[model samples]
Target: MTTSVPPADRRVPEAVHRRRWAILGVLMLSLLIVVLDNSILNVAIKTISTPAPTGLGATQSELEWAINAYTLVFAGLLFTAGLLGDRLGRKKVLLAGLAVFGIGSALAAESGSPVQLIVFRAVMGLGAAFVMPATLAVLMNVFERDEQPKAIGIWAGGVGLAIAIGPITGGILLDHFWWGSVFLINVPIVLLALVLMFWLVPDSRDPNPGRVDAVGVVLSVIGLVLLVYGIIKGGQLADFTDVKVLATIAAGLVVLAGFVVFEKRSDHPSIDVTYFKNKVFSAAIAAIALVFFALMGVTFFSVFYTQSVRGYSPLQTGLLMLPLAAAQIIFAPRARLVVDRFGNRATCTAGLLIIAAMLAAFAVLDTDTPIWLLEVIFFLMGTGMAHIMTPTSVVIMQALPREKAGSASALSNTFRQVGGALGIAVLGSVLSTAYRSGIEDKLSSVPAGLRHTAGESIEATLGVAAKLGPQGKALVGPANDAFLHAMHVTALCGAGVALVGAVVVAVFLPGRTPDAQEGKEEADLVPVAEH
Candidate 1:
């Protein structure tokens, strides 16, 4: 066996090191901006409501689609984007992605209608598909094996920070400016990222990359979009009998199965199916998906609950989320150390359980529940999320060979994106169904006119109520109460799902040596021991 130096000793050349970290900063910033935009619009929902433009009226599915469309497209195209990055250059694809994302955001800000916003959001998602995987692959290139875990930890921490702070930042902007301000905010950040990337980021591509499978891309995208659509509408449609939903879901599955067959037969595959054979990689990917599934669900519900149920203003709702951001920031560095010491299995399970418990606790909350209680749950969720999120990427990438790092990272991210998409689709559907049913029941005794309005979405209810002044406000109290109850039910469902995820981790996570890539290096240093 050949002797291998430690990653520190095999450091990147000094000239490259300086330039590399600078590029890393730019890349991370761009990624942070992408993540931050995901939930920043949540708090702005109420702010966007005007007498005319209004909130999503009788369009709960449309609103959920608006929120999830970006993630859906992102998840659908991630593998394709990564392969493209390998075929072309990472920097080239990344810059192109930023430009597309910036243009999409500008269009979203200028959107005159809900359909316009949703379409632009999908455009943004398509751009993010390119940006996210390229960022991860580029980071893998920049950092050596021993350095990778730390670097990944930092990157994950940045993502958590972005998620935590996004709503609050959006709220602040919404309070000071128009609701469109949230979308407009992306322009400056993306511009800066584009400029810095051009100046500092180096370009690299695989010398002999495999062919791009256009058929696979088409199949995967169609399957994912249909799957997401089915899930988003599942609650409204009869779970068993809705032909549209059932057909769409069935079509998605068939397409996905076909896509798998195509990949197995293709001379050049988008994802190396062999990666799933590794126990560490598989477990890590599963954990990553579960964690994100819970994370997205909670974040989505929290903003709606805080602003809609608690009578908090958009800015107030954002301010309420401060503790979550604070906890993540404070515990980020320590979370990595804990993961390293305890190993991934224990730390990851603990984190998921904590999140599940927090979600369960939120379920029991009423509109009268104190802010202190909310803060406590938010803190636990944030800390737990920080712990859970940091190590999965490290473990997954470390489990793979160096040559496969780019593909592996892209696949892991695909799982994460899938989790987020499912969370929004599933949980949003549940919430919408419950909220609508509750409104119908609550408004049953009201005047026929108001009852018809109650049959509409909460957005329309709020809009009509707003025009009625104090009497209108009083009239809508029961509807608001019902909505809060529905939110509580949504929280319970999320908690149960998270608990299932916790069980998944405990049962499936392999108790293997940590940081296998580093372990491989260590093995190269010593002679083989006698059996």
Candidate 2:
């Protein structure tokens, strides 16, 4: 196999360089809104599942769709959007994405039904697809090679900022306004991001962009939709063995396999699969995927644990998550220091192991567990993630030529989203199945017609019980018990996934290289920001 050297390092243009930090602020604002919408929705899941007037009266399965819909569309279209950002101007695409995202947010805020909400969320996803990858691509273009790691750390920290802001904002809005207010909040932020983008951010693109790979894009979307749908379907039914579920999942795998073959032959592939040939690059990518895979699954359940089981208000639940966000904010930018000391393999491996331990700690939690203990777990998990994400992102982003930054960013994020989507699907299925089994016997006391629905989820059971007046009070205890049991099972599974990621990093990700060790000595003398 022939090896090719990476392109020469890019120099930041004098004009762009002068106001780089200002441009970063605009980029972060754009990104925060996209991430905020999702994190905000997590707190609203319980609210949206309530009957009409207060919410859209969505089922547990429907609620999952509401989330997975955005993730699915966003993940499927990310690569294409990245390629577009490369071919077209990044600034032009970024502006369009903000506009579309704003429009989608408005529609979502006014959605009268769950189906409308799901469709609108997908619309939001389309806009976000363009926004996310473009931000990193633009960052890559504007920052110097030596300074890239620090800038990316700040960028990753912005995700932590979004995580901190989203749920609290959603909670405050929910306390005062209708459920739709959570979505409406995005509009103002989107507007601000657009205005600033026009003023501050500069346009950049690949000099020699390729033709759009329409066929490959189509196959990827189809394959992902099919796979996720099957997993979700199995969860809803609590039966993975069903012919429909197995058939849908199998078809999805087949189509994805076909996608790989087709991309290999194409002159201008949307995703260059050959990048995986670099073991370090592949390991870094896999580390990102698994990190999100574990975290997303745990996050999916944590909201319910705090709000439904522990009986906290939306605001309190959001507050409880602060430690998690705080940890990320504190450690993300500083993670490079840890890498300098221990190398990527050690730092990332330790991070993943910390993540695994924290995930497993969920097994010890119950309704009466000390709230402070939960906070500690959240803080630790965030710390681990910060260290892993910053280093791995630097590795992945620097792997290719700077011109391919959009595609590189897209590839990194595509796996992250896909991992998160599958985490929700697979671990969600585990939770659903376990909850159903644990609650099945207790559900018999319900009206025969409602037994299946009551067994669907803790939320559905509680909603049904609320309708039963005084008779409904009896079901609350059983529902909480079943949910806790399911959570334990799911958390253990997430921990296992994290552990696997740690092993991957240990095996394939490199230790300290002589070049990096020398670079660290110089980086110590001059802070990255000064560059």
Candidate 3:
């Protein structure tokens, strides 16, 4: 593989660098809005549940749908949207996505029913589909080869910042306004982003773009949606014999299998199967998926442990997550440097080991576990996240040609989202089953009245404890212990997954730096930004 350098004049041109940074700013702002929107709504769930017009009254799964619906649609459509960016102009599609996202946010804010909010959230996901890949495609086009790693690192950190601020922003909003205010928050930021894009960013597209494959889009969406639905519904699917869940999952696999066959045969495919032929791309995708798999597991149980088990308020729960965010902020830039010095394989393997160790640390938690120790674990998790998120994106985008950057980058994002969704579904199922069974075993010898109430919910049981005075509260202790034990067990399950992922990376990722191979393949393909 041969590596060619841009002419010194082209590499160092002041005007070109300024314009590239300007476009990066626009893409960063757009992504900030998208990432913030994802997590901001999380903290508002309680507010929406209590006093909002679209309150989730008595349906736990519907409550889950409020969050998972957007994720499901976002994950489902990403592949199509990425391919569309290749066929259509990235800038045109991205601007359109911004407008759609703004509209969806407004619709969600004004929604009067849970169903309407869920629908609008899905619409936002649709817009997100276009926005995400377009951002990277624009960056890949704009930045020179040598500059991309640092630029992508900064870009990844910006995403981390949005994640950090989301819950805090949601908390502050909830303190002052209705739950709808969270959705309203996106409108103004998006308008500002639109204005900046018009003034600063130039339009760019792939010159020899491929044809749009409508069939691939359909099969991909159907398959992913059904797969996510089955996993999410697993908790509520009565006795594992629920026909709807089984059928949807079965159909999803069939559709995806068909999609593979279709893509392989099609003259113009949306997802070019040949991209996976690159070892760097394949390994990077695996690493990215596993990172979120671990992260989503942490997110799911942390809230439950902090709130339901320890009786922390929503604000307190948000505060507890702060260390995780803070660690990312501190380590992300450093992670990029590490990757540069040690190469992807060494750096990524080390990082995954850190993550595995951190996940395992959570397995030892007990009612008497020290608060300081918990904070330390959260901090380590953030550091591990820095390693996982920062280098993986850079690796994946760098591995592909500029023309295929959007579709390649989309896979990175898609896997993480799908992994998170699956992690929550599967880990949630494990927690629910373990908690229920533990609660049942503990209540065997308790009075009949208490036994009946134990089957209700942890919240209901706690409420009952409050009413029955001190003695009643003592009876609630074992239930809390059982719940915490279940959480610890779930965390160990995550550690196991991370360990497996770490081993996979060590096995498959090339022992050498990937730049020489990448430089050869992309030699003829100019960046989209350069046009």
Candidate 4:
């Protein structure tokens, strides 16, 4: 006897099934723009901060704001944006997001001042907050259970692709065009996504949408913004003992604790706190965060190592980074097959361990280290990242109910952004402090005025060297050596963080047999009553 399929089981239509791949292409295209925006600004920072017709002459703090503005707004609003997508409709939210992002990009391209650029970047972040979660939510709705792992793998790989390509693309544009070209480049991509989404994507929303949790929204936004602000400030100061920094951080933590208490008591909560109770789900989140923490920290330092210390051109540095990107692209799609053959526990644990080893290897690097050896380490690091990222994302999504896809996606992406921000702040502080001390030790013979400039930063040191003629030539070697020393110190710390993350995964992440995972998926697929 044949069993009848319930209406809930029939939620996804045959047309959606046939067009699913096309839908994924459009979704990934949208994702690419958002992810690319995250890293593309890094290459353009120097160009934008230069004086006159070609640039804006932004101060160091203003330059930092230009970069941080986007991330801060993006992180602060992600959960709220996710909830809106779930309640209002994912496709509609995505379309609106694209339009807003496009507008923001155009305005940023025309920005006349650093303040204007920061404001425009924040607007783009608002748009990204809407676009990001909707992409994964739509993907979850369109793809069947069996196809999700592969699709998620491809989606995750887009992030790696963006990281690889953003610098190259930005470098090329900066070489031939104005600094604004970087922001303007996003316009065409956003427009293309908008048109395709309108034609191909279907609107999907939660059947039993909760009332807008105004209190929860306010609390989450305030808490996240304050927390990120404190972290950024703390990193900038590199002084945890500063009263202002301590007060800001303590305030943020207290408010976040209140947010948690409020969430638990709410009848119609914005996010279900119960998801964290699942060991696998929580472990997956932690792994993703820690991996990104290491990845971002390394990437930040490597850019300086390649460009400032080694003196590679932006385009050349981009080319040098190719191994990392290539490995991620190659391995990300294959991760699903590996997970199917092995298990999540083994795959994730091994990946983190490999990353830790690669990071430790980086700690020993010096000015004399072979370029090829660095490339090999990057390739291995990318491989480790792909293995961890794709599988963890798949497991996290699979563990969640379909109705919670928007929130879950936002939560995952939030962790990633937070980890990246913290990595840049914390690791950057470590690098800066070590480099400053080393530079001071070496600058004792230099003039006091020049010595201060040299100790300000590697860039400032190089600038001082350029002005000092023969004495400048003498300083270059010492400056590069100091920077390299700092890079090594930071790498050692990153390796320790990765090792700790591996231990967490080994202990908390569950091993899954194929039968067990299938059973869990079936259980998660139970039909809910239509609203």
Candidate 5:
């Protein structure tokens, strides 16, 4: 009540500040678990769906639900979670997230039915919503302005590492244990992260937090869920013109538009409507979205190409895919240097161009393509992605006010998740359509029943081929050729998308002219309050 402390004296101790790096480790570990969870389940899906002592006899739709449930819930709740973190406390929300995730993992491993597993996965996604945004928000709060790009580089690299390791890890676990072991692995990692985070991470919250935007939350959740549901359904049915699909998408878009208008008019908006006016911020978001779109599309085909076409075991396929992740790990940390020397606009454009070229290269792949050549393509693709992801993320975060870090992080990640989902839906539909047409044409001489069964998927085609004895041998050549044709078409489409993103990055992303950018940074680097 008596004395006023100096501003410098009010800042947290240097020792406490120095612990930020350690805190980042915990944050990365949390991020790794979530990222790994997304892909690890892919390897375990067949095992979980089979009928046996170790399996649940899940229907095809139920298996799809197991994956979609997690994605839908995660995407739906990200903004709300971010808002809660900023208003309550990031560390508090993060701890709660970790607890939920660990518990969900434990329960999921013990689940006896597909429905139970899907429900638990949704719970895990809710935890992920809290954890993902908090990680980035905390990183921005703790790191100095100059150091942020490097920190983000590491964080992005960790995601790349998770992508590479998840399938391999899942395959190993499934080989030696029950399919549930893949889910169980998350528990120990979550426990370790919880202990480290509690000890090292500092708590931070908005000093003048506003009231929760309940209406905005409801609108966002409903709109996103409906939109994703439509997309997933369209992909599954390969029918965008279906009445249900069209109606749901239309309704979701209308609701989302209403949400934007409401936010702009609200006094205590969940997200600052004006932030989108920053060209760099908007462009960075677009860049990240498109990068993921192209990456996911290619990845969907690559997995099929390796396992279904090349006849690699799950472990071998995972090992073969390592070049992509290894390149990102090696190059991502150095991306900041490139951005510093060049600029975000230039670096991102270059990266996108590289990605476009690689995707185009992938279009020409056939059954006869050399494994080494595929490895090189994957490596270059990862290198391009590393260049794009880290710099764009840094640019997006830097453009926002420090107090809005959580919301900004959530916005960034939400766009990424949406883009990935759309990629899989749209490109997957393209692949499926082309495969169906080509296989149907090629199987003109095949029995109608066998042809219909084989037309469903490459896996089913091979399975049917095996069952027909010597006559099944005739199906192999046509099926392989048809699948490769579909892959080529999908890759070309992805390349076109990447090229468009490159043009957008080049034209819209602000350049880092030294005087203007440095001045802006200096003006914006006001010290935020520390807990």
Candidate 6:
């Protein structure tokens, strides 16, 4: 019902324009909670794996499901959520999302079983699906095109802030309170965000949102669910070549292909699939996905390496991750300057290579590797990520017209979530297979009946060792060694993935030019209808 730039260049609403900064702050607050929840959960993984009263005693696979359930659902519904935000109203969708997120947080806090936790996590993901895209959409509508990059830089910085805070906060909660407190803490933050949003945030929506692509939505979700199930199952069983796994994975690909075909053929597609024809746009999306694939996988296993293999407590592990977050906070906002000088291709490729180097560095780390060296790797990794996320994001968002802001945001995030989820599943599988093979012979002293269980994961092996007392202590060293080997294999795999991403952006993203820079500067001089 309102436009910041009208046909005659009418004066922008003073209320909307004046409150832009405040609205940004509120949007960042919302973003922080969604990001914080996951980062906090990372530190709690080891705790949640412990038995009974103190923890949930969930298996490594179960812990992965808990995390992936959120990601899968978030990825699955994000496009739909974005469409709804564009159609219904960003402000309304945001409020609804925050409320659902709060309720889901409460439910997750009270979950009595791993199954319960996974389900509630999916619910949280559903809410998060709405929250993530809507926040970006509202920001796009409120900020002037010329200032959008700066605003987005700050927005990306908010993620870094959450990464810095989530772990330490979770650590403090775990040290003093229950594991659930990590999630329970979201309640008050959600409440505060809701109140601020109601007062400061303005509503905006596309005046003519087309009809929903119901069939396409269903196909995407089903395909994703099947693919992820297949991957997770293969990991859980340590047998990817199994008939069931192959069939499920193939079916998922087929369904996804069908969805794409239907969308291309449909009159009103959910996404303008043709945007991918732009080499720069497609390349940018690939960059986002590949970077997250590597980052999330590394993050998933780092906690275990620090806490389980190196004997750091949850708090210590949380503190250890600080260098990573600090580097992001320091570098993310300033990355645009680097891009201005280097261009997107050069900047992103350099960042990915740095990340790859850091990941490969993990291959040499051992139980006694100096802690400071680990910190350096974390810092470098973060520095790489800070650079990669910003410019790639700008490319993806700018590639689409302003009206499709919600869809653009959704597409970027969807690939990110999907990439991250697949990374965890695939890399986790590699870790499992490698560890099991390394430690299988060592388990010969154990009874045949329990050998499979002991070989399942480091956590499981340790649990069995503890039950055997002195005998168990003997298994501890071997378990650590096995995990180290697995980490080496997994880290190398991640490094390879990052290297692939580097090649991708280097090949496809455009180099710097005077015209491109001038266009960016003059973006706000006039508004044009894209279609």
User: How do the predictions measure up, each by TM-score?
Assistant: 0.87, 0.91, 0.82, 0.85, 0.84, 0.92
Q: How far is candidate 4 from the true structure (C-alpha RMSD, Å)?
A: 5.0
When summed lDDT is taken over every stretch of 10 residues in candidate 3, the lowest stretch is 1-10
For residue 451, give model 3's deviation from the true position in Å.
11
Q: Count clashing pairs, candidate 3.
A: 2
lDDT scores in order: 0.73, 0.83, 0.71, 0.76, 0.76, 0.83
How good is model 3 by TM-score? 0.82
Candidate 5 error regions (>4 Å): 1-10, 13-24, 42-68, 110-118, 136-157, 196-207, 397-406, 441-454, 463-474, 515-531
- Residue clash pairs of candidate 6: none
lDDT (C-alpha) at residue 459 in model 2: 86
Error of 1 at 354 (Å): 1.3
**Clash pairs of candidate 1?**
none
Structure candidate 5, residue pairs in collision: none
Whose TM-score is higher: candidate 1's or candidate 3's? 1
Each prediction's number of clashing residue pairs: 0, 0, 2, 0, 0, 0
Worst 10 residues of 2 by lDDT: 522-531
Residue-level lDDT of model 6, residues 1-531, one tens digit each, is: 122232344344678889999999999999999999999999999889877777887877788889999998888777778778879999999999999999999999998999999999999999998898788768767777666657776776678788898889999999999989989999999999999999999898878766778788788888888887788778767788999989999999999899888988987776568878888888888888887788778888899899889989888899999999899788877887898888888999999999999999999999999999999999999899888887887776556665555456567777888888888888888888788888898997677887988887888888888878887788999999999999999999999988988998999987765766647744633221110
Which is the better candidate, 2 or 6, if ranked by TM-score? Answer: 6
What's model 6's TM-score? 0.92
Q: Give the C-alpha lDDT of model 3.
A: 0.71
> Candidates ranked by TM-score, best first?
6, 2, 1, 4, 5, 3
| C-alpha lDDT of residue 319 in model 2 | 86
